[model samples]
Target: MRIAVAAPTGHVGRHLVPMLIRAGVKPLLLLRDPDRLAPDVRPEVDVAEVDLLDADAVVRAVSGVDALYWVDPPPAGHNPLAEYKLATASAARAVTEGGVGRVVFQSSVGAERRHGMGEIDGLAATEVALNATDANVVHLRCGYFFTNLEYQVDAIRAGALQVLLPVNQPMAWVSPRDIAEVAAGRLLSEEWRGRIVQAVHGPADLSWQQVVGIISEAVGKPLEVERIPEEEMRGTLAGFGMSAEQIDSLVGMSTGFLGGFTPEQERSVHSTTPTTLAEWAYTELKPMLQ
Candidate 1:
């Protein structure tokens, strides 16, 4: 099977290419600059350069593919929603026109709106776009990334871990690798179609403080998790290059996290390998903390 993957250098892409190769699927990556791919990932995957915004280019590039790993780039400047909408729209059009067979969209877990809670409008919009295509679309609603703790790795090393989360919502954190595994299954299998897959944390849900404690223990330090005012999160994020609108959107998203999510139905979907926060801290995130 021929698979086309966009933004194959991003977090999920790092694991996806290898899985695709091992599954005996020919992987073609759509990247702005092919050099961005890791050396090991690049050699095994075919490269194609096509601006996703350009219809003709997308149609040409999307043709004759069995599946697509759609990871639309966050828009340039400040409009993440606009970028998400436009990019997904283009991909949907191109896929329909090109007669692509399957699509595995990398979407956030709570991409739906809840009253006084978190909203996932962007993911919902992407789902609508992908649904319009003739191809079987599997929306992988990925859980909160464990890598979000990367920012705090430095703080953990410094012996003062300041966790900025506002509430103690139980969230199932999943690694990009696990997300890729689920996505690869959907991409490679024609049996499952037109379904939404919520890929969540391996073991179970963990609260913000629990995660902080786990990290502190992993680093062997008595770190402090200082909670900051919710009003300041947007401005604080701006320093990290997030646009004003993105800051707002993310803040709104966090509200959902504080409200909480359920792993009820998704727990039966399979792909649970059972890795915990402490395990990730001791392994993947340990060195970074040091």
Candidate 2:
């Protein structure tokens, strides 16, 4: 199968590409900056330096590809929602015009609601467009990234974790590596058909308090969970140099996940992944704490 990966340098893409290679598939990488890809892996894959906003360019780049691994990359400009619409539209065009066979789209858990989730609304667009296509599409409705905890690294070390989410609500905090693993397994095989919603729920459902305990243990320090108010969180994001638009999106994301945010796809043996926070913290986060 002729496979293609967009944003091969991204958190999940980086992991996904190596898995594809190890599985003996040479993937065509569609990216804006070829140099962003690791120097060592560049030689093994086909590179197309095409901006995702350009439909013609993306269609051209992906033409004749059998499968595609597409995720709405982080907005390179200030208009994130606009970028998501255009990028997903371009990839969808590639599916139809370029005759791509399968699409493994990286979407978020709250995408089922499809709106009011700020940037996640953009991901929902990808799901909609792919679903319209004839190509086999699997929308990996992923959970809140474990990497998001990196934002609280300093706070965790200071013995207090100011969380934005409701402390009592259990959320699926997953590793990108695990998401990539599931995506690779799906892309490499052709067992299922139609639009499949697979939730990448890591190990177990965990509350913010439970998360803090696991993280605290890994960092070898006791930490407190301070659930900051939305406005305060706004100021914090602004302090970090996030623009107003980005802040609004994040704030909306918080509210969107509040109540009625349960994933449409119920957790089952297939939906749950194996990696736990303790395991990920020890390996990925513990080292970062140093």
- The best candidate by TM-score is 2
TM-score of 1: 0.87
lDDT (Cα atoms) of all candidates against the true structure: 0.72, 0.87
The TM-scores of all predictions, comma-separated, are: 0.87, 0.95
lDDT per residue as tens, model 2, 1-290? 99999888887898999999999998999998998888889889999999878999999999998888887777866668888889888979999999988889999899999899988988998899899999999999888888888777888778887767878889888888899999999889988888888899887888889988888888798977878898999998899888888887778877888875788878888778888889888998888889
lDDT of 1 by residue, 57-147 (tens): 8778878988888876756757767776778777887788888878888877666442223235666677777877677877776667777
Q: What is the lDDT of residue 208 in candidate 1?
A: 69
**Which residue pairs does candidate 1 place in steric collision?**
111-120, 118-256
Least accurate stretch of 10 residues (summed lDDT) in model 2?
71-80
